[model samples]
Structure formats: C-alpha cells, structure tokens
Target: MSDTESNSSNRQTGIATALQHPQPFEESTIFDEYREIMTRSHEQQRQIYSEFKAFTDDVASWVKAASQFDNFRSRKRIKTRLEWIKAKHGEIEGVRREVVTCVEAVRAALSMLGGITRSLKGFSGIVKDEFDGGNDSDLQEPRSVDCAGPNQACAK
Candidate 1:
C-alpha cells in the first residue's frame, strides 16, 4: 500500500477505513496494545533474567565455599571419596559455565525488547517522514523526561 493510503483514511473509497491521519507521537490502540504487551513482556523477562542472575551468583558462591572446604579438609585414606569430590567439582564448574551462558542469552533477549521499541517508534517516524522527506536528524534527537517539567517524553 502507498504511504498515503497506509497513513490516512481513504474517505472516498467507501470501505471501512483502517488508517487514521498520522501525527507525531499520535497513539493507536493497536500500537498501544502492542507497546503494553511488549513492555509487560520485557518487564517479566527482566525479572526472570534477574532471578537467573541471582541463582547463578548463589551457585558461584556455593562453588567458592565448596572449594574452600576442599582446601582445608585434611587428606585421608578415602581415595574413592576424594576422587568423587574432584569429579563433582569439575561438574559444578561445567554447570556454572552453562548458567553464565544462560544469563547472557536472557540479557540479549531483554536487549531485543528495546530494539523492538526502537523499530516500532521508527516505523511511526518513517510514516511521518514521508510528508516532509527532509533531513532526519530530528528523528535522532534525544527526548528527555524531566518529572518536574510539564512535558515528560522519553528521548529516542
């Protein structure tokens, strides 16, 4: 569909018009629903990610404590048990590495939420840009939200 058609209602077309006249930062229920969902999903993911990080950190501390115990424990004639402890230590290290990888992946997933927001905001901006079709430097401008001020907008 043409930008014009996509951006505005085709009043003369006699079909139920889906488009509304585009305005800067104008809200849409569809976009609002999406933004709400994305925002909630992002927050949920962040909480999960935080919990995972805390779990990993706790595991790391446990591993450290275990190592300390192994260091101070007196050597005895229980060769089999000692070997088992050594093997378990290696297993713990492997699990720790896996947890770290998982944490990193979750962080990346969370970061993509921000990317999605940017893309949606850009999609809206691009639609607006069609009318002016001039330098898009303003599109790059950072918006600030000073709570004390009358205007509170998040910068792009």
Candidate 2:
C-alpha cells in the first residue's frame, strides 16, 4: 500500500503509530534500552517470587512454632517454648522487612517501564506523518525491485 494509506490504516486501526517499524536486522539504542528495561523487569519478577516464597516459608515456621508452643504449654514446658516463640517472632519481623523491600522493587520496575514508554514517544516514536503526510520529502522513492518478470532491474 501507499505510505499515506498505510499510515492512515495504522491510525484507524489503532494497531500502531506512524513510526517506521524497524526490520529484524535493524537496531537502535532506544530498542536496546527497551530490551534492558524488560530484562530487568523479568529479573525483578523472579526476585519478587523468590522473596514471596521465603515469606511463605517463614510464615509456616511461625505457625509451626505457635502450634508447638500450645503443646509445650500443656506439657508444662512453657519456658523453653516461650524462648523459641520469641525467636520466631523476630524472624517474622525480618519477613515484614523483606515484604517492604519487594514492594519497593516492584515500584522501581514499574517506574522504569513508564520512563521507557515515555522515551518511546519521542524521536524514534510517533511522527507528524502518522497524523498527516508531513515532510516525506526526505524519504526515498520506492524503487522497482528485481522481480523475476521481464522488466526487472537486474536484467543480467
């Protein structure tokens, strides 16, 4: 399709912007940052999941401590059980701190994603041509390809 028609179709369909898409072999620094941002986000996800698992494990330990405390009390071994309970409670505090850290990590990841999205809205981004055929004077004309027809560019 013509450039104008292609741009119009893209806008109408809301499928994408008028920004020229790069072919697979093309590379741009912005795209590199995009990849890095996504990579960090994935890593952060893994860390968060690991932290959540640790938190769950800590919670299970605390539950087990509580159950043991009740049994120990019934057996009149309350003093030993009390000391263990105090230590387990301290671990719960550590779990709380880990949760806070994970939340901060998630927030940071989201902020990075947002920043990258804003960066994508600039130069290597949507252009006036998307809205209207603007300043295409610099664009090269579409050349006839070496199609296997008789009137091909490479007649040899």
Candidate 3:
C-alpha cells in the first residue's frame, strides 16, 4: 500500500477506536452557571417581595391611624378627608396586587426554564446512545460521486 493509503487507514482505525469508547459526559459549567444565576434571581425576587410587603403594611397602618383623626375635625371636613384617604388607599392596594402578580409570573417562568433544562439533558443521552451504536463507519472515509456532465457541481 502507498504511504497516503496507509496513513488514511491508521486514522480511520483511530477514529473507530475512539468512537467505541466514548468519554462520559460531565456536568457542563454552563448548567452550573445558569443554576447559580437563577438562584440569585430568586433571592432578589424574595427580597423585593419582602420589602414591598413591608412598605404596603406600613401604608395600611398609616391609613388606619389617620382614621382616628375624625374626632378632631368638623364632620364635613372629616368626610372630605376620609374620601381622599380612601382613594389613595385604593391606589396603593392596586399597586400591591400588581407587584404580587409580577412576582408570581417570575416564579412560573423560572419553573418552566428548569423543566426545559431537564428535558434537554435527557435528550442528550438519547443522542449519545444513537452515536454509540456502531454507526462510526460513516466517519471512516469520504464517498466519491460522479459529476461528469455539463452543469454538474462537485461537492466536497
């Protein structure tokens, strides 16, 4: 055999051997990094939820305390003040509800991402198994095709 043919055969043998004993997949750093980022995001969300809850509680308490001032003011003045306070309280409650909704949405999205990551990991194993099932002959050598006619293209 010629030197080039001998070298090609050796290379193919090496590839076949390598394919027969594939390396085990290690946990990717990207997975760990994303997991860490998600954890930090969850922590931040919790902190924001706690702070918002505290602020809303304080607003509710202040509104309750202000209700006591009705005794000091004239009946007409007290009625007007109470109406304004009630409007403000309603606005605050609306904002509080929106915050809670936003937090819940974030949690749901994180759960979805976690599920997708797990599914991808499972799919990777199936792909690895398919490759390991003695399908390495295609990697041994390139196939030749005739392109003799006019307008024919030779693909590498």
User: Which candidate achieves the best TM-score against the true structure?
Assistant: 1
Local error of candidate 1 at 24, Å? Answer: 22
Candidate rank order under lDDT: 3, 2, 1
Question: Tens-digit lDDT track for model 2 on 51-138?
Answer: 9999999999999999999897777777778889999999999998997787677656755533222222322323111111244554
lDDT by residue (109-143, candidate 1, tens digit) is 75553322222231123211111213555544433
The residue ranges of model 1 lying beyond 4 angstroms of the native Cα positions read: 1-27, 75-156
Could you list the CA RMSD of all candidates, in the order they appear? 49.7, 56.0, 53.3
lDDT (C-alpha, whole model) for all candidates? 0.62, 0.64, 0.68
Question: For candidate 3, lDDT tens digit of each residue in 43-138?
Answer: 999999999999999999988878866654677787899999999999999999997787677656755533222222321232111112134555
Q: Each model's number of backbone clashes?
A: 1, 0, 0
RMSD of 3: 53.3
**Residue 65, candidate 1: C-alpha displacement in angstroms:** 0.2
Best by lDDT: 3
